[model samples]
Target chain A: MTKKTKWFANGYLTLVFVLLYVPIFYLIMYSFSTGKTMSHYQGFTWAHYVALFQDARMIQIALDTLLLALLSALIATAIGSLGALGIYATKKRQTRNALLSLNNILMVSPDVIIGASFLIFFTFLGIGLGFGSVLMSHIAFEIPIVVLMVLPRLQEMSTTMIDAAEDLGASSWQVLSRVILPAIIPGILAGYFMAFTYSLDDFAVTFFVTGNGFETLSIEIYARARQGIDLEVNALSGILFVFALLLVVGYYLLTQYTAKRQKAGVKRP
Target chain B: MKRKQVLFEMPYFFWLAFFVIAPILLIAYQSFFNIRGQFTLGNYATYFTSATYLRMTLNSVWYAFLITLFTLLISYPTAYFLHYTKHKQLWLLLIILPTWINLLLKAYAFIGIFSQDGSVNQFLTFIGIGPQQILFTDASFLFVATYIQIPFMILPIFNAIEDLQPSYINASRDLGANNWQTFTRIIFPMTMSGVKAGVQAVFIPSLSLFMLTRLIGGNRVITLGTAIEEHFLVTMNWGMGSTIGVVLIIAMFIIMSLTGEHKKKGRKHND
Candidate 1:
């Protein structure tokens, strides 16, 4: 809190931030380098970016990865929100605790265990390891997080509103759609965003479930990285970094807006 | 309303059974069979009896401990200091943003930075140490793993620090405790839960960072994850993979119990 301590604190934080961001910027910086390797400082060129744009397989895989993230996050959000509601509605504390523990299994298990077990499960069920398996695995892993995110919001909601809706002759469906859904929308949105990021960033689970022909961006990056540095992959990373920045900024703005609106609502009352 | 709620919850229950419970059960069952599809306990037998498997498990646990320890060391102070900074939320967001970038990319970045002529080596050479092998070493692997896990450790600790009541600190000061004494006696104990949570988050994943073992460790550092990947994907030995998978699960449960939250029944006064 003193001047010297404040300076020390600022310096330490600056060091940590530098350590965190250097790798990312280093990766992106090389994408524009004409050199094939990251060792030397070659002059800047747009060749890697141009190459990235032209790589049909990479572009296809990128689009597929995006599609997979969107679809899995959507499905997971729906199922997980319902699961939270169900758990909330349960009358028995033992059943509720049981449900909560069951929900956390996926969240706690290491990726290798989840991936290996899911692979065995799919093989036993005769489901091919490809897009379907990958999507299913993503959704499976994502559901728990969605439930975690939404359950707190559900707990925070007052029961009086639902009772009033029921007393005013609103049907169950109408009460859910008109009252509960609107109230819990922020949590649902947060869950969806978290799920989307998880799906997008997942490598280990996707690596196990993906068959020979299918690949996500993470898998692709892993493969190319093992083969040593590929500037094209670097180019793709640069673009993805920017895309991720945009997504984070957008999410931050959304959360800020909702928070402000909630404050205003409270003030008005 | 109850019927409708059940109708909506059907998919969730189905997911719980099929994906969550069933996969675990299936993996445990699959551990009994060999690659030939014959029923046997040979997989577990091999894992238990083989010296290689035992050593690998030990090494895996050792590396994970180191990673967790180093991550905790760096993150605790970072989180503690970060709590006192202005615009702390924004700073926290900056810490989290790096995590959103694909982890593989971050690892790949290290592959470049630690390479023969990479930045670190370049720096070393400039200082006349003249470019030694920086990549594919245990130190490099540990460094990168800790770097990746730092944010995770910081977040929970930061939250815990935020939750600490200011009155307690003031009370401790009023009772004539110095800063170090106050921190050691009060601040650290209260934030123990966050440290436990951070350890759980970092340690489990560190055990299975197979890709990091490959990409950065140059396949020199083999963890349980690397072994699982090799068995399931490379060797096509599903039985062995499942066996290792089961061991990993048990290890996870052991850790969970060790760090498991004990209900704060009543506040204890140290005075």
Candidate 2:
């Protein structure tokens, strides 16, 4: 491209990046302000962070959110990986496609629809709306994503390896544990990570199902935000910003490491 | 072996039945019931006949359209230009990083920026316009919604652009076509799938940004999502909410069908 256009493109990209990052940084920046509102930065102080740490309710909710994400992601990964495996092993294309579409219903449905429907589903089943309801909903919504993530890896695997394992007298369980699982471990991890993030980031579904007694961080922020500006939320955002950054970095590194290892394995063989 | 495999897959099947299929059927069934628990088609009747509900649906679609339009306009060029940049993957990751932050926190951030004494107001005041009420306005809502959706739009389009073969552009140039002509005839047409995917990603969610309407729109802008939330949570009208949920699902399907990849036709095999 010409220098003028190149400059223009660079400028445009810089502008878009600024727009994207400004809000996030603005929130994080105000977390240090001694002022009560985000509008004014009266001076820098760690008071909001200190308050965030000391607020017992907020701390408990954060821990609960973490626990919920971990448990849901774990269960979803196991079930979803097996679902992907089953889909792969299906001889009929129609059954496989039907299953795939069924799996994606939750992925495409708007969160409100999912939340409303799940609320109805829970109430109909006589399931009380609380931790149990929230956990189940998270697992439900998370499974589809986990399936999507792992299915591609399953497809990429060579079927001959499974046949070879069977010919060597490996049981189905042995084949799964020793042959298939190791090959798709990266996809499984990726699915688990995605599920964890989805559960953590989810608001609407959790909001609809969560009883008055239980609130995730998103619901709490929503409640607090409606009341007006609170720097404690900003403090939480600052910490979350760091946490999300670490997660992305870690995920990126993990994927890169796996890719390198795969290349090395291929080269050796 | 077959039995073992079926047993292994049992949980997934159970999940499919209980979570996916059952909730959908339950929602559809619930839509037939009125608020007082009587089984009737009144909720659908109310949604279809009521002027207020009709107007709200139209407004919600319009706002979502606007958000999608603006997001596309901004993101297309960003993605197009981003393709030529060094370290584009890293740049794309940076684009995606904001999304990882809790959406509520981002919305909360805008509350501060657009508030009376927020940065935008301060800029306005500096420009001699003085501080106007930027928050809770249609403009602020549109801006934030578009902002939130930009990364999603960009990612798909960038992938599409990256997927474009350089040979096509070079061939177009060799055939005496200029840059604009080449882009319109070759690059843009090839990237249509990505644009469709981007729209699919942005438009559906845009229709149901209930939290945005409440926090940024100041209840001035009521989307389908806001209505559903109000019905389910505030008014305790699960029936009406489910009716709206069904409508959203239908809308989702319509969009999916419209944007979904159509199979290529009429290609003859050379024997």
Chain B TM-score, one value per candidate, order as shown: 0.96, 0.96
- What TM-score would candidate 1 get against the native? 0.98
Q: How many residue pairs clash in each candidate?
A: 0, 0
Against the true structure, candidate 2 has what lDDT?
0.93
Off by over 4 Å in 2: B263-271
Q: Native contacts recovered by candidate 2, as a share?
A: 0.89
lDDT of 2 by residue, B202-253 (tens): 9999999999999999999999999999999999999999899899989999
Question: If you assessed candidate 1 against the hidden native complex, which CAPRI class would it receive?
Answer: high
Cand. 2 TM to true fold: 0.98
Q: Show the lowest summed lDDT stretch of 10 residues, model 2 chain A.
A: A35-44
User: Interface RMSD computed for candidate 2 is what?
Assistant: 0.7
